[model samples]
Target: MTANASPRRWLFVLTILVGSFLLFLVQPMVARMVLPKLGGAPAVWNSAMLVYQALLLGGYAYAHWLGRFQIRRQAAIHVALLVAAALWLPIGIANIAPPAPGQEALWVPLLLIASIGPVFFVVAAQAPLMQRWFAADTRAGDPYILYAASNLGSFAGLISYPALVEPALPLAAQSWGWTAGYALLVALVAISAAARWRAGGEAVGAEAVADGEARPALRRQIHWLLIAAVPSGLMLSTTTHLTTDIVAMPLLWVLPLGLYLLSFVIAFSTMDRLVQTITVVAPAGLLSVGGLSLLSSGGGSMMIALSSLAMLFLVATALHGYLYHLRPAPRYLTLFYLIMSAGGVLGGLFAALFAPLVFDWVYEHPLLVLASAMLLPLPALFPWDQWLGLKPRAARWTAALLVAVAAFACWKMVDGWTGVVADVKWWGIVIFAIGLLVIGWRWAFVPVFALLMLGVGGWDTVQESFSGMRVRSYFGVYTVTDDPEHQQRRLAHGTTLHGLQRTEAGKQLEPTTYYGHQSGVGLTLDKAEALAGPDAAVGIVGLGAGTLACYRKPGQKWTIFEIDPVMVDIARDPTKFTFLSECAGDTPVILGDARLQVANQPPGRFDILVIDAFSSDAIPLHLLTKEAIGIYARAMKPDGILLIHISNRFFNLEPVLAAEAKARGWSAAIRIDPSPTGDDFSDLTGSNWVALTAAPQRMDALTGGIRPRKDSRNEGVWVPLEGRARFERWTDDYASTLPILFWGNIIGDRE
Candidate 1:
């Protein structure tokens, strides 16, 4: 409030805003920098989040400790820290070598610490530190509102990286550009310091408060931690769930995180109405969306992704609104933020470090949803409680009735119903509508939500999960199920079907799914002897149930390169997929990243090589870069054929491949295999396979299978590719999925 302080208010706000922006911008940038060294699995982003949270906790603790110093000393110390951290600027991943297999989990944090630890720490402290300084200088103002501005800047940074920064600039440019922003942030922090240069140890916004307010109790601080942890863990779980259907690229990676930061904006703002409205809607959305998320997600990629994000925003806003409401006076502000950061680290560890090791499915998703239900401040919707003395009366009798109805629906979905659900929908609606009567009451509503979740899909997981049908690794979760009706065993990663094999006695020897007989890889392997001669050598990347193994010619040398050991086990086990066990059990299976492993191989080793890899329907960005292509080229003979399975649910990668081919003057063509709607549906999947070769004669051998285009349609034939505009050359330093993200495919129906 003083006129002198009014002029300085936006100065502190600017300092906090700039610092927070640079902090978040570096997170995704550095993660992308390290991506090639590891791999493009969704878990990689989750691990990166754990590191960010750990650093944030340290920053908050540092700010809280600084509160004990005099105002001028506090400002001086923070500025000194900022200048010191700047020595590590032009932020990039450390020059460390890639981690060994099974070492990615622990090694990721160490790598990040070496690279951006000091920069992120000093920047993260500015939000709380600047606000406290503003309060001390202004004499009286709610500095907490500045927290809203800080997160608003964070939302901007997260969103802009994927949308603007990444598509327009390369990694090297992005790094130097962020350094410029850090320099500006440093200047702003110094100006703020001069404006608040108080000499004595003024106890404003610090311990021994100016207002005589007591420190918050230990029990209450623990409550704050629990509340903050739910949304933190739930946000990561939602990201995993969404990317399972969409592609696991940075574009989609930023959406949930941006929303999470945006939630903090609303929760800490002066806009009470928006916060109240979201609080009223959050619990209901949690139950409804939570149930569908646990199931096959009621619809396509777009619908599931939208609903899950909405659920996260609503839950985050509701819980953070309560945090803002329970906030201590300005004296304990730093301590409050310190506790909140600790909770964030707890949640990230649970989801990123703990979940993959503990459970097979994304079991944390449902559990976090349940945790939200328990912690949220739910109020009754409509006048149901007002209209009813009847609600309390009904609660006694209807609890039993609702339980019985839930059990019946569970039966329809599970044991006796056997795929028919004619009556289940109406029964579920009736039970849910009745369950809404006790909206204000927590104890009654949670059971109804839990039982309804079971009826919808929980019981299916119970029966399906414990029977050894699911497995998890750093890459993703794998589910295996036998289709007794068709006599085929199936393998899936997330919602994407990776491979399947027929178990009909002698038919088990055939290859299926993406490698169907009409597929490009299929057509090339069929003519393997003609193209590479009798003793042809073959190398394959990504052993997904080893479906491509059955394509082997007798006495041909076939080799498998798989990154995930879990996938190796799934394919090698005779009990899982018979293709690898019976067809290529004796072949070599190398375990490591495909690019690195292929680079280590001797030059001109293979006559034919196939790249068939998927991390939950996402394209491996590292494998498609120019350097990676060069490594692959070195491993193959001059006349060798490279078959890359480019099928993806959320990206159209033809342009990227076309540009790579153009840069090297290699000839390339594609085959599109359409899945049928009939009896053979289980045995085939729609796919896009591109074949590239430096030698034109090698490509001609596979393209020769179909009649000329003048005589017939080029169905199952390799169509030639040419580079188009906006097709930037994809190198290790410069690559983006934005131009090729299949936006229409993600928003439209699943093709």
Candidate 2:
């Protein structure tokens, strides 16, 4: 390569690197700005990714089309686009109020696009486009190394936002910081364009190469899509498994995504050895750590094991990186990326949308593990020809022996073995070693140990997921377990506890789970006489294990509106819990979304409605929208009170409720109770409930009936919810999780 050629290649890499950094940094920066209004959640981040990818595809297509232009013309056109995008900047959302309560499904995505569309679209395209330009301008270069740099910038952006930017600044300052970064990116692009302009006629013009020069056929492109899609999907799947299915913590979510980005860095860099080494270790880790993920360590140890699982993610990343290394030339770059994007979108759809609908279980996690095992390159145990030295029949018999032994040992370990069984550790270690050998020589051993390890560890978790023992509703998973001292039933939404139940009088009529007797719901129910008469009609939006049914009094009418029929079945079945059978034998369990169900209900029916509908980490914004609020209000009596269970791990929803209360005239107060860690019946149950009422006198009655505490500064004003006030309303029709909920520290100057 000529000295001048080397300079051109480096310059190309630098341009892509700068462009990528700006591209990714802008995402969190914009998300942070809207978080105070949007609320924080994983879905918000997912939606943001979609926005970035969509705009990226658009930019790449534009760059591909522009390749037909003379170098000077392309530069001029791009510079104009950059300038036009900057006009809307200082980089922030427009001064628009958030979608009305519960409109997040629609308004959040729309608002995100409106706020950052131009800037994002322009920046996102630069990587693929600039690399193609480099291939045109540089006398000779791969341009793919620059692809690696772009992803490195992406990794830097994701890591820097949480670790450096968010911790250092508030939302407002973050916006300015990003604006500064965008200006720098613009400067970098200008420098490259200047270089290309100087290169002048040397910038190779597009040529119609012979059809013989064409690359992979359509079949190969489709193959590339599957390879790319599976790993990309697995990355997200790992996140779901770690957080929702296993440990549901921020670190878990960030680790897998971080590793994924880092993998691209390793894959694209001039380092082949690092990528190869990670892939070799990947298979062993997938089998071992994947099995470990199945162990129920509650919250603490599960977090540690989840971190270990990051190794598996790194492996997947390495494999994906290898794919990029083999990526086609600039002429076919867009096609390669188009396929890549399709895979990414499909994976995301499965994780975010379809998985919730298709399987009652969180299938993403296991599916990802399976995909990783298939994709990661396995080590060859022996020479192919040497293996043939053994008779074919003998080889087959030996393979069968290994399988039988592994299967039998697995069965004994799980079924025959009891607590703290002797030799269990050694046995497991030996089995793992044999499995590794099998993975080395035979691909069949992959599934063999996959099932073996899964059985000894993973299958246990799966079996524990049986009906009556465990429940997965749109809201989340609820588990009931028994011990020597006491029996307990717990409700968990993505690693966060929603409710817990303790044995009462040998029958589970204790309303001490999520809405335990000690909770705000319990406190109100205890004073049911003062709030309403015995025949008062009570409504509950979510009926988890029927814990609240125990609070029913004789002749009192009760109804439940639940979206997931599975949850109702779990709670009502005698095997799960008898909260309904023993308390309210005829508790009307209504199915479907609460908003639609409540709208269809008779007006002035419920005197007290407890709103507790949530699917795992999903907060049904539709249910809380202004329109839904009106339906709720209409369904209740004049003096009725509404209890909203707003407990979530990732967001501070109080402000949202405060905004609603301020917008709509109503009397409201927040009751705060910490979860009990002790064994005492009264001490173990805790909850936070917000009570709203149009009648101040009625709210006063409920408040007066409870133990008085210090005034709350957090609770905002009470304002009646008008119609679905024109803010964004999140409906099933249109929802994007991009505008992160509680993206507090990531945006501007606030720390």
Per-candidate Cα lDDT values, in order, are 0.80, 0.66
Tens digit of per-residue lDDT, candidate 2, span 35-107: 5344344446667767666677677667767666766887888888998999878887776664664675677
lDDT of 1 by residue, 1-751 (tens): 5665354788988888898888888888998898777666556676678779989999999999998888788978888888898888788778887677678778877888999999998888999988887777534367888999999999888878878898889999999999999889989988887877863433453222357667789999999999999989988888876656433443565677888898999999999999999999887887777766566423345666777889999999999999999988887889999999998888888888898889887778888898888899979874454565566666556556655665565556555334556666765665467456545767766777776677776676666677897888867878888889999888878766777888898898787877877788888888999998998999999899888888887889998999888999998888887888777789999988788788889999999999987665566888999988999999999999888988776777888899888888998887876775688566887778889999988777778742344423345666765457867888888887777776766667553
How displaced is residue 342 in candidate 2, in Å? 2.8
By TM-score, the best candidate is 1
Q: Please give me the total number of clashing residue pairs in predicted model 1.
A: 0
Number of the top-ranking candidate, with lDDT as the measure: 1
